[model samples]
Target: MAKARSAIVSSGPVGFLPVSITFFMAILMLLPIGSGASNIIMPHLVMISIFYWLSSRPLLMPYGACAVLGLCIDLWLNVPLGLNMLLLLLTRLFVLNQLKHYKGRNRAVHWGVFAVMSCGLYLISWILFSAIHSEFWPIKPVLMQWLVTAFSYAPVAFLLGRLRRWAW
Candidate 1:
């Protein structure tokens, strides 16, 4: 007798999903909003996607890929070099380490963890940028950025969750 395949976790790597998601994020980042006023926060898009894949399938989106994506974001956004890269590495490590906590967790739990991770990512980038630029980077801006990033997390998480549940 032949066996049936499940919709969850097809016979392939997670790199494909993260790659496509990250690419989509980069495009959204480039889109100009309201004549360059109050643009959408996209850095967390890739990060959230990366964190999802990293937490869900750490073997697929490893540290190297995370580092590369972070470097790309840094160069593309003209932010301080190595800052995002470091955060990417750290995020990957955190997810990889905390995989057990995510098992069968609720959506709010996952999204909340992503938001907290976003805060970490933003703080890392800010500290690195301030260290290099020697400018007064206030906590409020970072807090606002984290809040905005938290807002952006829902759709991506929902889509990813559905994809994991309904796709092969």
Candidate 2:
């Protein structure tokens, strides 16, 4: 029992990378990019971080940590409560379920998969917001955000892969 407890305690340091990186990304998203359209079209840094960690190191990120980070993002961004939390949780689940197939795949494959998933995520967000407001939200901004997010995945994933190596 003592050995088991120690083993669990030892995993905490390893787990710190995903949580810290995701939290840092979420905080960074709060920074002002620019005044009008630029801000609306900015990539979802936290979402990218979450997906990267979920794909590459699901054990490190874990569902609970993702939930907390998502909630933090929702509160900080002042969007509808639980919006990000649901999205992150769903993203994590999808990535985890598909991880077996992704193993041994090249970076290009990963990027392609991320692009599709990110688009779906943005679409879902648009639907949710429309439902909440009882009217259809303009999708141009969502499309722009999705495009930026999809294009940004490769570079962000590369950086995150480096971070994972350093952490390990």
Candidate 3:
């Protein structure tokens, strides 16, 4: 019985669960479900996935995967090339670096960290976009996006946790 249990536990990565989940998230972000106004408040689903997976299972979610998915998001959103890629890569790094602080902590800590990181990422993006266009981009939409993404993090993280348990 011990041998059987160990075998089952050691069965390294049963499938492409991590990448597929993150890809599904990227697809969700790409879907044109709402009007332009609606998109302004769209949650950063891909970022959420990257952050969750990195924190939960860094081995399964690598920097290369984040970069690829970010590129897809950048292309889909038609933003400056590599914008999402940069953000996603940064997210992976940030989560990894800060993982020690939150690894054994409660979900609330994770949510708080996520909220702060999401806000920072959006602010950086807004700055970059403004610099690229050489004009002051309105801050309202950025704030809306940060709020939506921060509030949505808990539910999304919960769902991802469920997926991780089921898959792993």
Candidate 4:
């Protein structure tokens, strides 16, 4: 109970990312702007959110967290169950593979690379998912999602950078 109480109190500072993630998802779900006009193949918001935590604080945000978050995404967004699990797994692997590239860089370079890599991974993921499903969804929507997600990258990164020291 004491641990729970402290957890609740400590949450005051650490709550932003999780809250922002929900906000992004809420916007993604509620907004019908891109519905008839376009369809985004890659789930960029979820991908970007996962990438942020993976880069910023791997210890506090584990693969299990990623997996659960992915599952929540699947449940909340009503996508395939293991699809996001696979994406999260691949994202974790991608970040892990590039650990050296990140560890020795300034935060700007790091987040920049994070944005680029997330964009690339989303592309590859779109291909793989399309292939697995045996269809090409579309290019325009995915590209639009890339643009929006990349746009979101900077602010989320700025916030994460501010919270970096607190993460440890």
Q: What does the lDDT read for residue 145 in candidate 1?
A: 73
| lDDT of all predictions | 0.73, 0.84, 0.86, 0.65
Work out the TM-score per prediction: 0.82, 0.89, 0.89, 0.67
Error of 2 at 82 (Å): 0.8
Residue lDDT tens for model 4, 1-168: 987855664566564455455346545744545465565343355666667666654544467766776676667766667766777777888887787677767777766776677678668767876887799978776677777777776776676556555553
**41-146: candidate 2 lDDT, tens digit per residue:** 5578888898887776667777888799889988998999999998998889889888898867998988888888888888999999999999999999889888
Candidate 4 off by > 4 Å: 1-43, 163-168
Clashes of each: 0, 0, 0, 0
Error of 1 at 46 (Å): 0.5
Task: Report model 3's TM-score to 2 decimal places.
Answer: 0.89
Better-scoring candidate (TM-score), 3 or 4: 3
- Model 3 — which ten-residue stretch has the worst lDDT? 6-15
| Inter-residue clash pairs, candidate 2 | none
lDDT of 2 at 137: 92
